[model samples]
Target: MIRGMRGAITIEKDEPQIIWDETVKLVQAIVAENNVQPDDIASIIISTTPDITSAFPARSVRMLEGWEYVPVMCMHEMNVADALPLCVRVMIHVETTLSQRDITHVYLNDAVKLRPDLITKNV
Candidate 1:
């Protein structure tokens, strides 16, 4: 089955290094939590808040070893009043036997506030 794993992380500033570092951190966490390999990932869609224009998260993801062939895209999240800024979010489509309820969705740093209800009971 193809499952979508969601994750998000917040950066302290809109710097290229910070964006890349945090994006890598978020992806690593997602991969570790789910035991997914590069070949298992179908595609990754990354979105950053409008305030974050310093870098493209896709650049960071594609640079990961063995992820060069994985399809990935990056875009800016819709800007909403009072919405979280400096945030990077991702939806990774992967081939997995794990049920939807068992899939872990990671939210790190201040982004954890974005999904307070995503805690998986099976973990």
Candidate 2:
């Protein structure tokens, strides 16, 4: 079976390193939570807010994890008024045997506030 897990996190600063570091943290948490092994990750799609154009957060994440073969993509988030800025959102398609209810999702930084109920349940 395959499962889709979703995660979103916000960077406190617009700087490249800060955003990259936080992105790494978020991905690590998400993968661990969902019990996704390196070979289990089918692909990852990441998007960042328009305000963040310095670098693809996914690049930093892949480098940190040393995952060279995982398919990764980074794009600009849909520009909208009042949307979260400096945010990195990810949707992971993973090959797993776990049921959907067992899947874990992650939200970090200000994103934790976006869905406090969910984060509280996981944390």
The best candidate in terms of TM-score: 1
What lDDT is reached at residue 123 by model 2?
Answer: 37
Model 1 residue pairs with clashes: none
Off by over 4 Å in 2: 120-123
Query: For every model shown, what is its TM-score relative to the native structure?
Result: 0.96, 0.90
Q: Name the TM-score of candidate 2.
A: 0.90
TM-score of 1: 0.96
Task: Give each model's whole-structure lDDT.
Answer: 0.93, 0.82
Residue-by-residue lDDT tens digits, candidate 1, 36-119 = 999999999999999999889899999999999999999999989999989999999999999998889999888888988995
Model 1: lDDT to the true structure: 0.93
lDDT of 2 by residue, 16-116 (tens): 89878887788888888877777888898999989987777888767855577888889888899998778999888899888877877899877876666
